[model samples]
Target: MSKKQKRVLIRILISSVLFAAGEVLIITGSNPFNEASLFAFFLIPYLIVGGDVLLDAIKNIIRGQIFDENFLMALATIGAFAIGEYPEGVAVMLFYQIGELFQSYAVNASRKSIASLMDIRPDYANIEIDGVLKQVDPEEVSVGDIIIVKPGERIPLDGVVKEGTSSVDTSALTGESLPRDLSEGNEALSGCINLNGVLSIQVTKEFGESTVSKILDLVENASSKKAKAENFITKFARYYTPVVVIGAALLAIIPPLLIDGALFSEWIQRALIFLVVSCPCALVISIPLGFFGGIGGASKCGVLIKGSNYLEVLAKTGMVVFDKTGTLTKGNFKVTEIYPAKGATIHKDEILKLAATAESYSDHPISTSLKEAYGIKIDRKQLESVEEISGYGVKAIVDGKRVYVGNAKLMEQCSIDFERKTTPGTLVYVAIENSYAGCIVIADEIKEDSADAVVNLKNAGVKRTIMLTGDSKAVGKMVAEELGLDEVYAELLPADKVNQLEELIKQKRLYGNLAFVGDGINDAPVLAEADVGIAMGGLGSDAAIEAADIVIMDDRPSKIVTAIEISRKTLKIVKQNIILALGIKGIVLLLGAFGMATMWEAVFADVGVSVIAILNAMRALDVSRYQG
Candidate 1:
């Protein structure tokens, strides 16, 4: 318990002892004072437990902020004392204080659960000067600085490993417990704990731009964006409190004056009970707490939701559209097969050699794959004229022979007769000395979890699973068929992708949202255009991440399904809290107004309902059951 809560506990104990003593004296017929003196004696315990609440009500009244929970509580208890009900008044305040203590503890626990992610903030960076390591604040560390991280220390900046090798724990950032191994020349992100060996890292980004800083900024500002349900509760409390307060006052005064033989004390007691039951504390506290717990739980699963508003929208997702490369498939291209033309003098190795040599100077992904497949040094002395034809391929003279390396379009442009391959990959046709030589097939590999992601989405009740890609129709069809996507739009440019997404958006169900998933710089436009933009944080460009509403830290498509599940579960819990709080309060409120309930029932309506709803909200933070 916090110190403030400790003080409240101490006050509660003292007041309870005093209250019990007075009741024992009254029951034993040993009361030492008259009615006036007894009232003064009971005032001591009432003020002890509820002084702050009365003081707050007075302050808010003076500041023109009436009709809050404190005001309702103070007014109800004070009216009890006016009607000579000293013990009942004291009991109401004591139980209300206990409820307040429960709320304080619950809120603190929820903050700690979410703030666990803030533990990733590094305290200092270790810099070497004059052959000795010196600790400096992370903000003082600049780009291009070399920082040394010891075993069991958190990495302070984003950098590449200059020397040493070790496994680093990325659980704080990626929410995965597995430790990633790093060697020399490998990229090391900040906020990861160096587990086993000391690592010398060359910094690539400044402290402000590091991954840790970005994530911290995202988490700290998450609560500012509230969901529609939370907003409704805020407005509801604002208007509901004043209306109930006025109703309670009319109930106290008008009934006794108009009804013959209606005792004023009995009607007044009923009005006090009505005020206590209608405090609106349960609805005011639990709704926002539930949404916050949901966001924290998602962070624990490697998904960063920008706000609760997006969490609300994700629960109603009807269609999920994906960008093929870097989102569903690994963007790395590799040579999967090789085919030499029939009746050609060139062998498979020779065909690869000529293709790799002709495309040596180019830096395209297909060129890099060809060079890696060739696995030999290209002697540029064998080349004479090298020319790149846009929309085609590369034309060069290799070993005193004219070599043309490009697509089937390039072959037709040069009038070279080549056998077209029907394989599901990017086929690169090659021609030497104006004759067909061979074809090398390059393909991007699919991610392991992508198929599971599709299956889970369908199981989760997503109506449409679609893919939008800039790859050829054949390659796109192959990946879509393998993943069992409901729809596929292929061979599109960046603008064309947005157009296709817009068309898909029009086809979604009413009250349902569409989400676009992409990871490239060109994907920024389409990501922004979607109802919810999900970016693959790992290996994704800065533009895409900036435009996205949610980020998947480890680039697993399956986590998207996890996010949807978390969102729907959160929405369910919030609805339950709303119904639970309002349902119990409504029944007791009507009973209190009709004189059918007493002060104890009023306490249960306000305090008991709040505690139950708060405990239910805390369940949103337990996401372990949702993880694989």
Candidate 2:
């Protein structure tokens, strides 16, 4: 399928053929115990398998890229050959190439996982022109353009159903399993296929801003943001290689004169063993591979980690901060309670409709949700002379009558005689002809999983979980208590939230890292300041995702805990590999120095340790074992 794949197959083929021939030669008694001939037979296929690897090492040495794995491997094997250990030389090279191939396949597998995630890209878009079906580029389409979609096709842009109905699968974006049912006038997202029904949609956004493009872009570039830990090994090898090479030279020459005429073969043989033992295979290959595995594994769970540096920070976060609106609570405002004044003829719906209609001409959160609940589109013609007062609300002349929709302060300014209802939420009062009609109590409620997320974070080992919100003290306290949070601050402006995060970070500085999770344009400042900036609901503004170090694709705050769990697990694997690699290397290096170990031991130190570390790195695949 690829050049690397084809070459690996070729190497295996050559190794298999030569191996069989070598066994026949031994059995036929042409050379029953001629280890050199047996070694020659073994080395022929081994060289065919790994000749390119050896050549590359020599090329790099000539090109001044002298301190690399290839040079170390080449020097070690050639030294063995010079010491008249031909079979050992070939065996060492053969196993070293096998280890290199293992790491190569690991890289390919990681790319495939990310590619599967990116495959969510929609293949085509539907365009409606002159009452006829035609295909068009999604970029050429604009808002309000009608697009026809057949059954089992993905919608290329965010749009409303101008015609037709179907079940659309959204698992690509949210990891959600259910297929959502769509009807006329309902909105559908990109990356979702129209299943079992012909559909037409009015385009809402351009192709670049569509969910599919954003997701694919995010995943494709995920590896770029998150660098592997191997960078440290490269730096370590730069210094470590030359120092060890000099040490081996000293071991070869210095001991000979000091011992009153050291034998040439014995000293050179010991130096060769020293060279094999000091290949630095364990530190060079496994440490960084551990971090790469961690990052790739977390990506499979939709956590966009920016780098290993952040993964390290996340592993040590003892205190975590959160923004209230859109982070802890749902950003949408809802009518919590409706209070009707004495002798009012209107029920709750009638009061809601009047309020919805008065503010229908304006585009605001309170107005939008009110209009949504009315189940009727706003008639702009009926709404006349609409004027919005900044920091207040909108007032307009409708149906030859003046209508008002605003807070208690707006009502007080207008001298409306309406009784205020003391409640645990914001109160939107309605007035007709400057006379109070009724009030609708509204609040941005806590998300259903918010409390569970706090609990899970605690179980995930966070020492303290905090909430900082712009809402009133009562509302903030209610949510914090419900979620069983450790701390909370209410009625904070954007700057106040940052200041609070600063103080908490200072207090928690002694313990470990402090993480802040937010999904608001205003939260960008604080998100950048935290040790680990995690943004919930990455579908939020780019200002939020770009400012934060980690982005959760799903709105669930529980994913924050999942990310922490993943980081901890990843770090644990890294530690395990380090210990295993170093421990094995240490034992063999001592034995190699004393001539108690053979070339096989050197193979284990170089190639065998690498294979074990790689197998350990693949443990990052089982995310379910780490996630709660």
Candidate 3:
């Protein structure tokens, strides 16, 4: 318990002792005081337990805010004291204090749970200056600076390993226990711990732009965006409290006047019970706590939901659209096949060498694959001039021969007749001196979990699954069929992807949501246009991550299923709390107004219901049952 809660507990113990002593004296016929003096005796315990509540009520009344829980509590207990029910008034305040203490403890535990899940923030970066290691704030570390990470420290910035090899634990960032081994030239992200070897890393990004910083910013601001259920409760309490107070007042006055020989004290006691049972503490506190716990649970599964609003939308997702490259596929292209022209004397190695040399200056994935296949040095001196044709290919002069390396469009643009090949992988046509040459086949492998993700989404009751890609029709169809997607739209540009998503949005169910997942910079527009934008954060571009509403930190498609499960569970718990609080209060409220209930029953209606609802809200934080 917090120190503030500790003080409240001490006050409750002292007040209970005094209240019990007064009751014992009265029952034993040994009361030392008259009726007025006995009331004053009980006032000591009442003020001791509820002084802050009474003061708060008075302050709020002065500030034109007289219809809150504090006001209801203060009015009801004070009315009890006025009618010679001093012991009941003291008891009400003591029980209310106990409920408030439990509330404080529950909120604190939720906050600590979320704090521990996002505990990846580093305290300092180790930089070597003059062969001596010095610790500095992460913000002070600049790009290109070589920082040292020992076996037990977190990588403070995003960088590449320049020296040493180590096993890195990314469980804090990805929620997966498997450690990745990093060697020289491998990229190391922030928030991962170096487990064994000391590593020297050349920083590629500053602290502000690192992965850890972005995640922290997302989590800290999550509560600012409230779910619809939370908004309803805020408005409900605002209007509900004032109306109940007026009803209580009318019950206290109108009943005594209408019924013959009705005693004022008896009806007044019923009004006080009505007021106690009408406090909206359970609905007000438990709903938001449930959503907060849900977000923390999602972070444990490597999913970062921006706010509760997005979490709600995720539960209603009926359609899921995916971008092919870097999302469902590994996105690592390799030279799978090399085809030589049928009538040409050029060998396969010669075709590969010419294409690799002419396209050596480009950094595109296809170009990199060709260079990797050649596996030899390219002499740039043999090239006279090189020109790039966007969306086609490259034209260069190698050994004083005109060489054109690109797609079929490039071959046609140069007016070179080439053999057309119908292939399932990407095709690159090579032309030399305006003559036709063979084409190379490059392909990207599908991710191991892509099929599993599709199957799980279907099992989760998602109505449709689709893929939008810029790849050729042959390649896109192959991947879509392999993953068992329900629909596929291929050979689309960036603008075309958004248009397709808009058309899909029109076809979805009226209240259902559509989620678009992508990882490239080109996918940013389509991501923002979807009902929920999910980004693959592992190899995803910054533009995609910035526009996305939810991020899968480890680039696992399976985590989307986990996020949806968490959202549905949270909404179910919140609704359960609402019904549980209102159902019990409604029955007791009717009984209290009709004089069928007493002060002890009223305390149970308010304090006991709130404590039970809070305990139920805490269950949203347990996600172990959902994890495989």
Candidate 4:
């Protein structure tokens, strides 16, 4: 618990004890009204519990802010004291304090969860000066400086590893369980832990431009962007408070003057009840609390909701658009199928081996997949004069025989007749001595949870799932079919992707809103253009994450379903509180004005409804029950 919460709790305990002691004395034989000593004794506990409230009411009155809960509460309790109902006045203040404590506690709990996210801020950096390592503030380190990170230290800024190798625990940023292995020439982001082995990194970004700094800035400023529901409540309270105060004042004055035999004291009591019942505490306290809890719960699951407004819109999403590479697929090329052309003398294994040998000296993704598939170490001495034909493939002499590995363009260029194959991947054609050999199909592997992600999204009421990719139409169609997507738009440039998303958003407008998910630097614009921009924070570019309203920290598309579920549940809770508070207060207000309800019922309508609504709002924090 926070210190402020502890103090509120302590005040609650003290007030409760004093109120109990005062009640005991009243029941034992002390006449509060007749005996000065007894009245002072009872008044002591009332002042102990309500002194602060009365002082706040006076301050608000002096500042021209007279129509609020504090003012209403002070007016009602003091009116009860004037009527010699000391016990009722004391009870009203006591329960009001109790409700305030609950609100304070709930808000504090949410702030703590968000504060935990801010813990990723790095404190210092270790820079080498003349072969001596010195720890200094991370801001002092500049780009291109070599910073040494030891075991169990957070990487202070974004950089590339120049020396040594280690595993980095990226769970704090990504929310994944696996540690990413890092070696020389690999990029390392800030806010990740270097697990073991010393590493010398060449910094590529300043502290302000680093990934951690950007994320922290985004989170800290999130609450300034309020949801529609929150804005409605603010406007409602502003108008509602003043209207009820005027009505209560009219009730106290007009009834006694117009109606014969209507005593001023009795009418004043009814007006006081009206004021208490119309405080609007329940709606005012619970709506923002519900949204705050939703954001906190999303953070716990590695889904950072930038604001309640996005959370609200996410719940209304009917269509979900995705970028194929890095968002739906693993973005890593792998050899999934190998086919040899008809009439080829060489076997399937030989085709792969030759292609692997020709591409062994290359560092392309397709080349890496071929080498990994070969599984046998290549002897560089046997390969001679490897030459890369841009946009086609590679040419090299392997085992004293000239080998060629590339696409159909390469075959057409060499006038070598090759058999065409139907497959949804990047096919690398092989040839020896200008004769057609075979082909190897390499593709970006789909993530394991992608299929499940689609299923869960449909179950969560997502009407359409679409994919946009820069790959061939064949590859895009294959992935769309595999993932059960509704539509696929392929061969798109970054601008084409944005246009396609805009069209989809327009098409889906009649049904509901649309959400776009992506994870590359190229995806930043589309991420911002969508109804709700969701970025894969774990491996995503900083630009993409910054433009996004929601970030999936673990880079799992399935978490999109989880985020939608959380927003929907939070909206449900908020609506429940609003209806419950308004419904009950509407009926109680009529009863109080008609003199049918007593001060006890007015207290329940004021404090009791607030407490119940707050408890319901707290349900948004228990997000574990939501499996999606």
> Against the true structure, whose TM-score is highest?
4
Give lDDT for model 3: 0.80
Candidate 2 C-alpha error for residue 418, in Å: 3.8
What value does the lDDT take at residue 71 in candidate 4? 73
TM-score of each: 0.62, 0.63, 0.61, 0.67
List model 3 lDDT by residue over 1-628, tens digit each. 6788888899999999999999999899899999989998999999999999999989988999877767767876787777566886887787667656654454353223223444568999999999999999999999999999999999999999999877787644432233556878999989888887799999999998987776565444432232233455435756777788788889889988999999888887788778767766566567666776787788888887765667778888999999988899877778888888889999889889999999899765678899999999998898769997645678999988999998887888889988999988878999889998899998887888999999999999998999998777888898899899999999775557777988998977663789999886556667667878899989886656766778899998988899999999998998899999899999999998887887777767776787898799889889997667
Q: Give the distance in Å from residue 149's predicted Cα in candidate 2 to where it truly belongs.
A: 40
lDDT values for all models: 0.80, 0.71, 0.80, 0.79
Alpha-carbon shift of residue 508 in model 3 (angstroms)? 4.4
The alpha-carbon deviation from the true structure for residue 165 of candidate 3, after best TM-score superposition, in angstroms, is: 42
TM-score ranking from best candidate downward: 4, 2, 1, 3
For candidate 2, the per-residue lDDT at 264 reads 59
Report the lDDT tens digits of candidate 1 across residue range 359-476. 9987656788999999999998997799876446889999999999988978998998889999988789989999999999988889999999999999999988898886768888
TM-score of 4: 0.67
Model 3 pairs whose backbones collide: none
- Per-residue lDDT tens digits for candidate 4, residues 1-628, read 7787687677767877877877787788763546566557657777877788899989988999876667776776776676556666777777667656554554344222333434678999999888889999999999999999999999999999999877787644543223556778999989889876799999999999987776565544432332233455445646776787789889999999999999998888788778667766676567767887898888889988876777789999999999887889887778998877786668889888888988998765677889999999988898998887654567899998898898887888888888888798877888899888888888888999999999999998999999987677998899999999999998765556766877887786576888989886556557667778899989876666766778999999999999999999999999999899989999999998888898778768877887899899889988886544
Residue 59 shift from truth in candidate 4, angstroms: 14
Candidate 3, superposed: residue stretches over 4 Å from native: 1-230, 238-243, 342-354, 357-364, 374-404, 409-416, 422-426, 431-437, 443-445, 469-478, 489-503, 508-511, 520-529
Question: Over all chains combined, what TM-score does candidate 1 have?
Answer: 0.62
Clashing residue pairs for model 1: none
lDDT of 1 at 102: 54
Candidate 2 on 301-379: residue-level lDDT in tens? 8877766667778999899888877777776777777777678876888678778888776555667667876778767
